[model samples]
Target: MKYKKTILATTILSALLILIALGVSLVVSPMVERKAEQLLTRYAARVGAIERCSFSRVEFSPLSRSLTLHDVLVIYRSPKGLRKSMDRLEISVPLRAAACAVPSLRPYVLPENGSMDVCNSITADGVSFSMPGLLAGSLKHAAISGVSADARHVRAILDGRRPEPVDLLEHAVIDGLDAVNLRATVQTGTGSAACTLGAFRLRGLHDLGIEEIRFEQLNAATNKERAGIALFGMDGFRAPDAATLRLLLSVRLDGKKSPQALDKDIEHVLPMLQQWLTATIPPVRVLAVEKASFRGSRPQDVMSLDLMRLDWLSNRPREMKTAVKDLVLPAQLVESNGLHLPGLKELRFNGESDTRDEDGRIRETGYLSLARFGQLRYNASYAVPGGVFNFSLMQLLSMTIHDAAFSFVDQGALAYIALNQHDPDMAGPYFNQALDYSFPGRDNDALRAALKVFTDRPGTLDIVKTTSEPTPLLRCFDVATLGRLWRVSATPGKESLYDQMRRLAPAR
Candidate 1:
């Protein structure tokens, strides 16, 4: 009877001890969780200026010093209003250095801990950011790891959104370009903000990378609106450097898609975004923006424009033009659409085109430059009053000559030859063999009435000081040719010079 009583007492004592231990553990866990969340919120608010950070479930193990949170929602104040959400966040602190968990990385103080496990987030389901009514960006199944506790540096594998292009033109069409496996690192200091993006490929485009992008700062606030930097802009541009900016970067995104639908509100607001930003944001300047393997209306009609990449600089509205006024090019631009431009050098644009209106007032003056092709260098301009390519220059033989010749000639040689009953003109039999042309009324000169357009000696122009008036296209010829049928029409005393030539020609 004594042995039975002792055994029973011992059993009851053991059970009571176990229950007490469990009660204590359960009671302390909530306190630890609260402390961990408070620390997280305090540090995060310092780094990102987080307004509110809420998590549905917070778990902490005091013994192990490990913390985890689920369904995290973070709000930040900057360029307009910004919001970020993540699925799970986990942080581990070594027991030896719990005090140094936040900032002042004493990685050396704790040799075992070279870097503090400040943040290890897993958006296993998805991640998202938004600006109230304006726009939203999303990425799925990404683990953005290794964020410094100080929040000055971080890396992410972002397979997600690039800024949606603002196409104000109605009935606008677009191509698909979704990125994948984008490995990017962002680091910011007092002077500038820099990013390195690589190992990324745009669907149907080349593998792209950004070697360097150093921005002056991301201006999140300018006092005009209670918004963030997205509202203000970046230092992507500087007015003093409108002519040129010394920067280097490489990125490509060419997607092929048919315009499936259009949201009228989105279309309207998209362009306003650029305009509204121009009024506030700092200029985000870049050295270049190039595209390759871009398809257009027809799949086979791959856009192989010589200066498409640089056109973005010159084509933007005047206020936004200075942002990237001079877009430099790489040595070679390539794409998957069987289109390639090798040995391309630079685009020295003046941000204007010569396309004139019906009144003949000089309109936009665009595309004037000294660019290289193969071993040859050339200058091309679409500066004509009507935006037609009025001039082209390159090497012809040894001398640097320009065949400023493009013809929609009038009363073509055949019609004139037939009208004259095969009468020999200034060109004689060669005139019959010359180009058959038409469009006779553009020229009003009576002396050279047979040929509406004539050639000239290609001379260079000062792009800055060049005249801005609607002018006729010059059809220049190799001046050194003894039997050259082309004449310099604009020369002083050109009529007299032509008269002598007419007298020497075989009688009509």
Candidate 2:
């Protein structure tokens, strides 16, 4: 009888306990829901939106004292005239945090001990984005993996109806203390327009610091009529092995715009662009080093001239074909800068056109060859009506040597100009000044003397005798010119000519 009574009492106690637990759950369930709603409202207030949110189910566990949520979405609209459409986003966070900050659920708080996952898909008129996995944890850090976007038929309305398309792929891994390391690639193309930026890496995201970044390849191709300017191929730009103190930019213009028209626009808008870019883009200020190298390969017969290399360090780098026709500029003064260069160190040109031979026979054969380095530093400034002006300076110092304290004091001052007034004939005087400076005469002895500093071993320049009719490869300033000026001989025992040339070249 005693055993029976004890068993019966135990059964009753167990049933009562079960009922009590069920009652507590019933009461807490509504509280949890209310808490979630309140939390969402608070978040909406902070972000300044309420109608842009929707939520699914929220569940709590008593055993672990944790909360889990599903299907949380947030949508936003971008400002007018932007490229994108609606910015649709979705994220899932731990219910604990979501509940603790609720305004309606008074004195009820959930502990923070869980993780969150976010996935978003945004689509604009021409742009589309999808991120597969974005995760955050209390103990661990946040990360985004397998993120991709497709941007086709996109247009930047700010600069007229410019057609733009962009495709991006990115992935990132972060640590507990908010250290992020990421890699991404972006490619854009529209019509004949194309651009690619590959092999990008970023570290220390909060402050926008890049430990190492490389542009493995960059290329653009566009028809002349569409591009608005002469097209140049900027093949591959590599940074020095060490970290750079300054910023470098490689921009490509590939659209249906004439080079002259583009130049005019650029001339008018470059300052504004510079100001906006410097102010809006955080990365620009951190970059202290800058270098731009270019290459171009045009179809034969398109023009009368041949392609040439642009050697930044040469005394007279090869000249690029400008749209200006019949300008009557000196051959030596090919560029805006007063200094005549030897030629570009690297270049390749091929094509043929009628020279109007006396017999007037058409010739189809053409030849191509590499170009040599020429001019070093070139600078020129021109102004148009309405206070519009354009000026540029090319520094020939090598990236390696320039970073080692090449002085820009002289050139820097020249680059600074305040064109508050209009001057249309500025190009003429600048052109004339370049011609006068580049004339081959004793008048430029100071420049010649300065150039001599670049040649350490000036005597090695050998003038080999030609047995056959020597074909003119291309017109370039040779070390022989420097040697002649130094009155040095090509004798076998003479000081190393290369060393002398280096000595004659000006130090940065």
294: Cα error in model 1, Å: 10
Structural similarity to truth (TM-score) of each candidate: 0.29, 0.27
User: Residue 81 deviation, candidate 2, in Å?
Assistant: 7.5
**Candidate that would win on TM-score:** 1
lDDT of 2 by residue, 1-508 (tens): 9999999999999999988888887888678666766666565555532335554666654433444444444444332111211122223333433343344541354222222221121111111222223211111112222221211111121112333211111111111111122222222343333333322233321122223333333333344311112222221122221112111122226767678866766665565443332232222212211222223343221222223332121101111222212112122333335442322222223322111111111111122222222111212211112221122222111111000001111211111110111122342244345534564566445444443332322212222212222212221133334223223122222333332223323231
Tens digits of per-residue lDDT for model 1, 87-186: 8666555553454443454343334312233433222334566766454655444433323221111111011222222211111111112222222222
Give the residue spans of candidate 1 off by over 4 A.
1-35, 45-49, 60-67, 90-124, 136-138, 145-477, 481-508
Q: How does residue 262 of candidate 2 score in lDDT?
A: 68
Which candidate should be chosen as best, given lDDT against the real structure? 1
lDDT for position 60 in model 1? 73
The per-prediction CA RMSD against the true structure, in angstroms, equals 21.1, 21.1
**Number of backbone-clashing residue pairs for each candidate, in the order shown:** 31, 74
